[model samples]
Target: MAQGENGSIHENTGERSPAGQEAAQDTSLAPRRRKPWFLLVALVLVAAIVVLIARKPKDTQSSATAGPQIATIKAATAHLGDIGYYVDALGTVTPVATVNLYSQVNGTVTDVHYTEGQMVHRGDPLIDIDPRPYEAQLEEAEGTLQHDRSVLAQAEMDLARYEKAVTLQAIAQQTYDDQKLAVEQYRGTVRNDIGQVQAAQVQLSYCHLTSPINGRIGLRLIDRGNTVFSGASNPLVIITQLQPVTVVFDVAEDNLGQVRDQILHRKALPVDAFDRSQETKLASGKLLTLDNQIDTSTGTVRFRAQFDNNDLTLYPNQFVNARLLVKTLKNAVLVPSAAVQRNGTQAFVYVVTGNTVKIQAVTELTTEGDVSAVTGIDAGTVVPVTGFDKLQSGSTVTIQSMQAFDSGQQRLERTQDKSGSTL
Candidate 1:
């Protein structure tokens, strides 16, 4: 029985040793098998990298598809014209002749022949003063003159008789001499009475107040039956000549040389007068005269322009704006007023070179209407009018539409429009 048990134990030990060896082999083999899992993790990481690389190209492609923002430009060119240099000033329109009607004699206003605001001619009666008292005084003086004339006639006859007596020695020398002296005294009295009568008659004729000039009359200050005196403070009416009006204005002393040159050259300094709004021209005239002396206080010289105001648009004492044409430049390069940009004292414009924009400096000569006369730019030079604010020197500009640019050309083409027509 002991031998049988030993055999069994040996067998068990042998089996257990084999199983342990197999377990050790399996443990070693399991690590070897996990190497594939590590490789799978590495493969997954590689694939993620590949996906990232592929997405980068798509993002880059999308970014490449977008374009840069662009701005529009208006290209224009310059032209030549007769550019006028004008000096603008404020002024007043006054009548060539202004008069205030007043009474010459003291009397009641019996009649006003002219209506208020009526035009009157020279020597036209404006007012009539009461002449009854003056007429009575004249009549009294005339009667005294008649009586004196009769006395003088009788004395003259006596003088004649005395002269004859003296020559013939029929009368005493003293008596003839006395008769001649009496006749001379009577003649002197008659002359004095006649002078008084003539003076009274002259005074009676002064009852009528006449207009001194051809003009339009203002409101009447005194009505009929209103007493007026020669020494009254205010006039009965004010009259202003309207046919020829004068525009008075002041010019700066700095412009005196140019004005003098214009006059010396016999160039008609065209002057235009506008109303208070400075919109419509009331009348056009030539420079008539410049004051002899400059005003020291204001440092300006006064000037006058005369206009035939037959239309009556210019009223006396009306405030006006005057434009004095100083000089004209022939074949001057002019650009639209909108194209010129001012920076401090400098003027500049944007010029288009190919597709790039460049800022060009310019000097202004004069401005007329909507155009500015400049010196730096030449004809056929493309200048940008709009979208200049977004531009810098050497910036690329894309013209958005030719039609939009053509509108500016249309403005130049439409100069003959009815609204722009002027006399």
Candidate 2:
């Protein structure tokens, strides 16, 4: 050991005093302790900065994906063609003529000339009644007529003799006049008897029941051997004409002017009948006549259309839907009715171009089936029919399908069948 300045003791190597050595150790420890803490703090700051940087991109991506999505829709193109204007109405099929047959004389039904539901022509015998009593009455009238006629002849002969006697001055003028008056009275009696014979003949002919119209017979109300009377409430059978059947339909009174104009200008306007679904066409006919008065309660007018029901597609009292074609618009701008949307009273459509839609105003003239005759939009313009709810004035759109609308009824019917809806 050695002694140094300030009385500090040193080790055998003469290195330094205890105070200097402690000071050096303290300085080195300070640097080591500060280095670990500074490194830990720097690492924490770096982790925070890296986390912020990663989160910024995630947030930006979330915002970008959260924007409004494009809407998908179906569209159709407008067509330039003809569209028929028609008036629709509910109708009932009626027979051209209906007749109920009843016996005109009281007698037993001896024979039935035809089967039930058989077709018969006018004056065709339907039922044969026992005419024995009527024949007897006719014979008695004939006998009385013969007796009266003989008496008249005898009286005429006597009058002739009296007339000659008067001319010769062998008889008084008063007596001759009486003989002439007697002859006249006998002649009048003969005429009366002849009239009675004719009446009896008519009564005898009534014993045979015949059809008054050409038609199909209904169920027989009276059977053979059953008694029938002229004044009976029940008829023997009912006959209805099937061919050339008539359809009675009621049209809205507001459309009466158009229908009347067409009828006046074009005779026998075309009419069509359809089934309950209004898809199946049953028959075709022509406008026959209109009722004398309109039904005030329903604001409608009854019109009759006649059809040549050669195929018997129409039946008496059958219910059907009628459509009368009044006019046809040529070179009309037509579009699908589904594409038209009403904003209050104004009609509008979404015209799509380049994946974007623009609201367009259009004038709708008339709608028939799934088509609408419109004005404003030109033919060949694309119109969106679906996705209207997700759209605005300038919304983006993705067309799922684009179809061509036919002005003809073929495509219209096909669409109806697919959707099972009216439009």
Winning model by TM-score: 2
Give one digit per residue, the lDDT tens place, for model 1 in 1-423: 688899889887777777788998998899899899999999999999999999999998888886444668775677766666888888989789888766778989899899989999999988888999999999999999899889989988988898898899989999988888888888899899989998998888888778889999898688888988877788889999998889999999989999999899887787878778866667778899899999999999999998888788888888999989887777777787778888899999888888888889999877755677887889767777778768888888887643222222233234325223321
Q: Itemize residue pairs with steric clashes in candidate 1.
A: none
RMSD of model 1 against the true structure: 10.8
Question: Local error of candidate 1 at 370, Å?
Answer: 1.1
- Cα deviation at 407, candidate 2, in Å, is 1.6
Instruction: Report per-prediction Cα RMSD to one decimal.
Output: 10.8, 10.9
Work out how many backbone clashes candidate 1 has. Answer: 0
Best by lDDT: 2
Tens-place lDDT digits, model 2, residues 1-423: 234643453343477768888998998898788889899999999999999999999999998989767999999999888877888999999998998777788999999988888999999998889999999999999999999999999988888998899999999999999888988999899999999999999999988878888889998778899998888989888999998899999999999998888778866688888899998878777899999899989999999999888788899999999988788888998899999999999999999989889989999988877889999999889999888999988889999998666784555456446644332
lDDT of 1 at 11: 83
Evaluated against the true structure, the overall lDDT of model 1 is 0.82
User: Residue 296 lDDT in model 1?
Assistant: 99
Stretch of 10 with least lDDT, candidate 2: 1-10
